[model samples]
Target: MNPSLRNALTRLAFMLVAAAAALPAAANIDIQHWVAPNGARVYFVESRVLPILDVQVDFDAGAARDPAGKSGVASMTQSLLDTGAGGLDEDTLAERFTDLGAQLGGVADNDRAGLSLRTLSSARERDGSLALLRTLLTQPEFPAAVLDREKARAISGLREADTKPDAIGSKRFARALYGDHPYGRTPTIESVTAISRDDLVAHYRTHYVASRAVVSIVGDVTREQAEAIAVQLTGDLPQGEPLAPIPAVTLPQASTENIAHPANQSHIFVGQPALQRGDLDFFPLQVGNYILGGGGFVSRLTKEVREKRGYAYSVYSYFNPQRQLGAFQIGLQTERSQAAAALKVVDETLAAFMAKGPTEDELRAAKRNLVDGFSLRLDSNRKLLDSLAVIGFYGLPLDWLKKFPERAEAVTAAQVKDAFQRRLSADNIVRVIVAGD
Candidate 1:
């Protein structure tokens, strides 16, 4: 063979290998399910690859359920749920978990509150950890001392966050977009101080019903063991009234507010309340967003704001669909001097996309990338458990994950254009730029 031809063939072989390496491993997820006899929703995935059990219990008691004046109640309530429960005090609970070689964690977000346990699948470790969880869920003592300390900590954190420009922008943006809705409120120091032990108990009783809970278990656990675990965890909770349906989010009219913040860079966010979890437009909107801004370097916003003009270090956008309509936001940070220029480019890019949706090539690439990357989203038991929790919480179809790629592939250019046309209007977007001219 000629030397040049041989070198070219070697390069082609290397390229093919690289391309194959880049593709994600095929997804072979097998999700199983059964309702606990106590009425708790149970989602399980049995993976014997590792002798670890990752269990998570999610409740609908999130920040959105905070009372009008007590914007932080849900947050504080969740934080204290495991702090003191059953006959055990906070210190004893911590010591017991440590002795069992188990890890316990809790998360409180806008849409949900969750308690998670990670332990060895051995009987002693698993049973000990699960017993603690059962107490935390059904027998929280809500000790007065723990409540006072956590309240003080929460208040102090809120005070510190108040001084941050990004925090101010986020709170104001949520307020502006959600208006009088519960989603708009941010917890204040005053509200945190007002939260009493009784408040936590009441919130838990009302929202932590078995029917409203989803128990997700993944790892080396049998079907019988999973059912037994779910029953033990949720068996004693009072079967309260069904969760009050979350009302629709009415996106308030667009309005610009200039919050005075003494910061060197301006944080600008433009968007409105958008879709919910099960909305028909989710797939199209999600795929279109990757083309518009969610694709990092390949996104239109990054190309316009950073690559082309160098107005900001980073510019990005995403759609967050929660139980209620969450926001579809474009965010960027730039020096006060370049804020106006950056904002203009973001607006122009969004306007153009709204008028003429993603091109066929752009749509195809977005779908291809998203579909190919889907498996990675469920590669681990923790990831699978998280996805299952979301599915069970939102009443999404059991086949949502299996069907995700197909749906992305089926999203036509016309559907992407139509979904955006009906769901978002450029004229109705709220633009908030702090420290900008």
Candidate 2:
């Protein structure tokens, strides 16, 4: 086959895999898990539905792991992984993937950083992509010129964000809730400017080790092939010492900060640290939140704050469960003049929900909505790979996805109320309003 035509065909195959419909919920997702010889935790699900595979390797290296006074190191390190690795420059590395019909991406969040790949499962394409991925994981060049360029770009982006009212409100709200915890630390221009190449190399060496790696794989691969893939990917990783657990999140004293911004709308955030990832309270809190504010226009927050009073166009609440205690946040934007009234309604609604919990009808609806829609979460190989990564990284039960509906249905109104009351305290809640009257 002509080289160009062959490459185009391979790319089309990958696109077809991505566009394919979600595997049926009834399709057995038998997950196989093991630890590689070099200590990488691996979880895999095999599906013959497509001739493509998705792989994600997660590490305990995220923004929260940034060294003091260097808040953007982890993120910068992750981004620089593919820029130059194994003697390949940025453009060559990217073009190599293009020729193989594979996609490589990286993610950095509060608690984890990692690379993800999607490639055609044919032996040539799969082998070539995995080889590149292995090089990225083990031998990133962290080229000096690239580091200088990215640092400047990051600083520019941070400066731009500083001027936005929503961004100001978010940063203040994080600090108010998390106090001095790393979770509260946002990357400022100064912090990114201070991140030298040595900082990136050191952060990568400390955190990107075999022991901290979680390799999740999904799609058209056999168990034996998957095992070999895991070994090939992580076998060369540095055998660094175990990472120290992140510090616990200290709940903050209840306070409200009103920051002046020359914007027409007020951005508001409410609530406090409430749930950790994989907590027993996840279902109860999630179901209850749907009634409180997560159910879109049908939620009580929307009814009172947006529909009835027209104080805001949209309002919502959610419990973001991270490795440590994450925030239970209520967010909305409204006309500056109505910020106070909107906030008042949000607070009252939240207090009432915490006091009485979701109504029976609301609970049933929430469960139904979650349960009926659960299949959507698993419909794609990429989605399955994501869930597998969470399960592997967080040490959640292997059957977590399979049991979601059962657990969600089991949550009672009393459980929801008790969970909320125990987790959220009015005294420790933080509220930040930007551009409010």
Candidate 3:
């Protein structure tokens, strides 16, 4: 090889290495926020890596706000929103979505109803997908035929779910925890069957209002284009009064109930309703829960219930805070013969943790794992978009993500013990064990 040629190659390689070293670290996520002229909240983040667009429209219409005797109305209403809209029938709407190569979806949980769309970023695809979203949000047809079919499906699902021991335990657990609250009532087959097209239409018109919706958009689009899309999608939505406020969730009085079931394994749901979105105790509780159960194989529950005694394959606990007070549930399934022993161990562990709290080593490991694992939560545009939506919907601070690590690291052992003692009382916890000896 000539000396000149060899020297040139070495220079090129050195330059490439220098350039790579100069590149910035990848922890930054650029989020943009604005309010639409029509009063809808909009959040956007542009990413050109993927030639796709993801949009979600969320409303305050959740099951907790359902009226008496209409336990499933919120979910049913959300389902029918996109089934038939504007002048399109269900079949036509589905065909159009498929033809455009777009996916339309809906999700209904205890605290919100959401409709989402994912489409290619091409102009034709974006416009077509947005048009369908507009119809679903504004001009849902709620045709009589589609309503009947959906009702039948819901009822059939309920009937099938009733036969399973896990299902029975969950249904009874919710009822026992929530009592007469809307959150406690699972939709009955009869109640679902009674829901009609008019009922859904009325529910949509009342709750799916523009002022109540939060629009989240992420992907291959500019801020200007995202604003136009948001308006075009939600402009025609009814401008109605804000939804009626959800009443505070009252934590039920403490009690233990063991229901008889024929299943060979017992299902247990134990805990109480605790915490909400902006609660001050959230960070401490979250960190403590990691030590208690949410941290997979490293969690105390797993160590006690599975590794030590082999009583169950898995055991977990989590604090699900929502618009109102949410449940802090610990659950496991074990052979009926071993259920009592398993429950005893679980209670002992929980009681000991509450009284003494996690040790220094446990707290350090929990913080390390949570902080180190935070990057994976925001690695994709879709995940970032979802986080932005939750922040917007729950009115969390714009810097919530940035502050998460600091909060986790700041949690003291005394604070965890104090928070747990204040938030959870073993004597006041609700214990439901199904098919236990």
Candidate 4:
């Protein structure tokens, strides 16, 4: 086949798949899971509807896993995977993916870090992409020149972020909420400067091992093919022991900080550490949060602060469930003069919602919205791949997508209220304001 013609076909197929993905899909997500011989957990979803395949391999190597005093190591390590792998430099690596019409990506967060790939499922493209991924997994070079260049770039970026009000408020809010926990630590110039090429190699060798890997594959592939891909990707990795679990989050005492900034608007963040992944309360919390603030204009927070009082352009709240206890944050920006008044309304709204919970009608509407829109979540192979990665990495049930709506519908008003009351308190939430009066 002519190379140009093959590339065009790949593009057309990807476009067709994307168009099909825009429609609602069946809620029944059948995930076939197994553990590879090398101890890598694998999750597979076979979808022959599209010619594209998506794969994500996650490991317990996110920010929380960064060595003490090396806050940026995990992110840097993941970023540099394709910079130099299997004797190929970064530019050559990029050319290979381009020529194959495949996409290579990376993921980094507080709890997990790894890579993802999208490619045509034909044997040539599929096999080629997987080979490159395998090389990244088992043979990243961590070249010294690339490390120093990236370090300088990261430090420059961090310095620029320090001057922004929203960034300052966010870092301050995290510090206030998580205190000395690793979750609170964001990369600073000092920390990034402290990291060395040796740190990246050590972090990868310690955390990016076969035993800790969760490989999630979705798209046009058979079970046998998927099994082979999983093994081929992880088989060469060292079967090192999983690292110790990240420390559990503890609630910090409530405190209010008003940082002086020259910005015209005040950036405000308020909340506390709340739920973790797989918590039963997620259903109630998810349902209730929509009524409280997650819903757009209809939410209580938006109605109170943005609609009635017009104190801010927008206000929203959410519960971020993570591998460890995550944040329940309400965030907004308003005129500096009205910041305190807006915050007062926010506090009152949160307190009332905790005390009374969502009304019966609110509960019904929330459930209706959530359940009705659930199909869209699984409509795409990429989305399915994300769901698979989460399920495999977190050890969630295979039927999680299938049963999501049922569980959401089962949440009652009383349950939402109870969950909120138990999980949040007015006294313990941290409040941080930048440029407030």
The Cα local distance difference test for each model comes to 0.84, 0.90, 0.84, 0.91
Between candidates 1 and 2, which one is better according to lDDT? 2
Local accuracy of candidate 3 as per-residue lDDT tens digits, 199-226: 7777788878888789999888999899
Candidate 1 clash pair list: none
Model with the higher TM-score, candidate 2 or 3: 2
lDDT per residue as tens, model 2, 21-121? 64747236788899988888999998887778899999999999999998999999999999999999999999989888788987799999999999989
Per-residue C-alpha lDDT of model 4 across residues 281-389, encoded as one tens digit per residue: 9999999999999998989999999999999889999999898899999999999999999999999999999999998889999999999988877778888888889
How many steric overlaps does candidate 2 have?
Answer: 1
Q: Which pairs, if any, clash in model 4?
A: none
- Candidate 1: misplaced stretches above 4 Å? 1-27
RMSD values for the candidates in order, in angstroms, are 9.2, 1.9, 7.7, 1.7
Count residue pairs with overlapping backbones in model 4: 0
Candidate that beats the other on lDDT, 1 or 4, i.e. the better one: 4
The best candidate in terms of lDDT? 4
Error of 4 at 4 (Å): 2.2
Ranking by lDDT: 4, 2, 1, 3
